[model samples]
Target: MTDHNQAIRDDIAFMRSLAEAGRQAPLKGGSILMAAGLIYAACAFATWFAASYPVSPLFMPTLWFGGTGLFFVALFALRRRMGAKTETNRAAGLIWAGAGWALFVIVLSLMLMGYRANGWWIMAAICPIVLATYGAAWTVAGILTQAGWMRGVGFGAFAMALVCAWYGLEVRTLFLIYGVSLLGLVALPGYLAMRQAQRAAA
Candidate 1:
């Protein structure tokens, strides 16, 4: 019985050590958020321009897909440059990655189901989905890091999502709001995280 108890205690200690190590790991440089924000903003602008001008429908798809491709390529390069991730970092990455994939699947499914029939509703739904993803990831990160500010950010994201849903704004206006949200929620938080890491290192 004593031996078993000792083993359990040892396991607990090991887990604690791992958690501590994770907490000490260097923060993400926020490149992903910055890149995503810029890409999203650019896409929004391009979409608006296409609608305002006599541009072909094909142009919008090309711009969006091309911009997405570029963003992924940049993300890959950034990850490679960052080298190996710690356990906590990997956990965080998985959360955001899963959210992104879910968003893609949701959007694709909606498009496939004839979005033209309910274009306005579809557009409004997209914003909440995005904001929810951001909120979930940020909230989880905040819990892990014990960062009060991050929790506030996560709540703020959810609030924004609610506003988007309630207003059911037009696509062009929604895109503009989304761009601003990305800057505030993703880019700004990422910048702060990087700065915090730098200060810790210094």
Candidate 2:
């Protein structure tokens, strides 16, 4: 076949594989519902954590969690699409996805603990690590998936955290709160929902 015809064939095969995969799954509608739950948890936690430290400057934490909410919202929506389509091509996506959450946890820990540093020092230390883990996961999701948005939100969170550090925000302990509000509430559950569907579809 010609290259263009071959490409079309490949797309058709991909879709057919998905249809076959979707036939043997547990839950379909719940992915989006679960995402909704996760988002709620994140918002509630963010509110709680932010209130506890009314006087502290957790500007980064605020932005981080806020960005987190958006990311999860997008992720959940994306999951709904994939799950509703045929089979969720989530097997590879799930593997890398776990690593992404792990890195987020680590970054938030450091950020909340008030370890803000100077110059390229922070990026040199943290950025690569975060990128390495999250990037791997996003790559598995493929360029066409929601990986780009997740990567973008993650980078935004990191940048905001760096700025917060520069201004000397009190990040200690608050990182836990931020993590709770952000990942636990958002990414973790969102990851779980999609992963659950992904694995089922796989």
Candidate 3:
């Protein structure tokens, strides 16, 4: 009986230690946000330019896929360098990573199905779906960290998604909206979160 009680106590203490470490772990350092934001923004601008010019349609696919690949590489590098894979970090990473995978599958499936035949409406619909994923990621991060501002960012992203949907079919407008949304919803809040993490570490 004594040994059993002591084992239970040991387990409790180990769990508590993990919880504390999770609290101290900086789940996001803004690197992912900055990298992804810049990639998407560049893709948007490039797509807009392609539409305005006589560029081949191939440019769009190349730019989108190449930039996304670069972002993923950067994200992996940042995570390896940070080496803060606490439970909280893992949870947050899973949420965003899952969203990323879902987005990829949806986009790929759309492309494979020749959804582009529907004109810009299909692309416009994609923007809302992407934004909703962003909102979900931020909201989950906010809940995990108990950060009100993060939740606000999530909501703001959702609102922007709706606005983007409303302004449909204009290539330039859609790209511009998406670019700005990345900055406001992802990059800025990520910067703040990074700063908060730094302060907590200090």
Best by TM-score: 3
Global Cα lDDT for candidate 1:
0.73
| Candidate closer to the true structure by TM-score (higher is better), 2 or 3 | 3
Ranking by TM-score: 3, 1, 2
Candidate 2 Cα misplacement greater than 4 A, ranges: 1-56, 84-88, 112-124, 138-202
Error of 3 at 159 (Å): 0.2
> What would the TM-score be for candidate 3 when compared with the true structure?
0.82
Instruction: For model 3, give the 10-residue run with minimal summed lDDT.
Output: 112-121
Clashing pairs in 1: none
Write one digit per residue (lDDT tens) for candidate 2, span 71-186. 57766676657534333445544554567578678766666453555332342234335434433443433332333444454454445345434433333333333434345323
Writing each residue's lDDT as its tens digit, candidate 1 over 1-202 gives 9999999999888656545755686456467766776777678666655655687657856886798899889888877766566666776777778887998898677665645676535545777778878898888777655577877989999998887677555666676677678788887887787777667657
Candidate 3 regions exceeding 4 Å error are 1-26, 115-121
Backbone clashes for every candidate come to: 0, 4, 0
Count of clashes in candidate 2? 4
lDDT of 3: 0.76
Residue 150 error, candidate 2, Å: 16
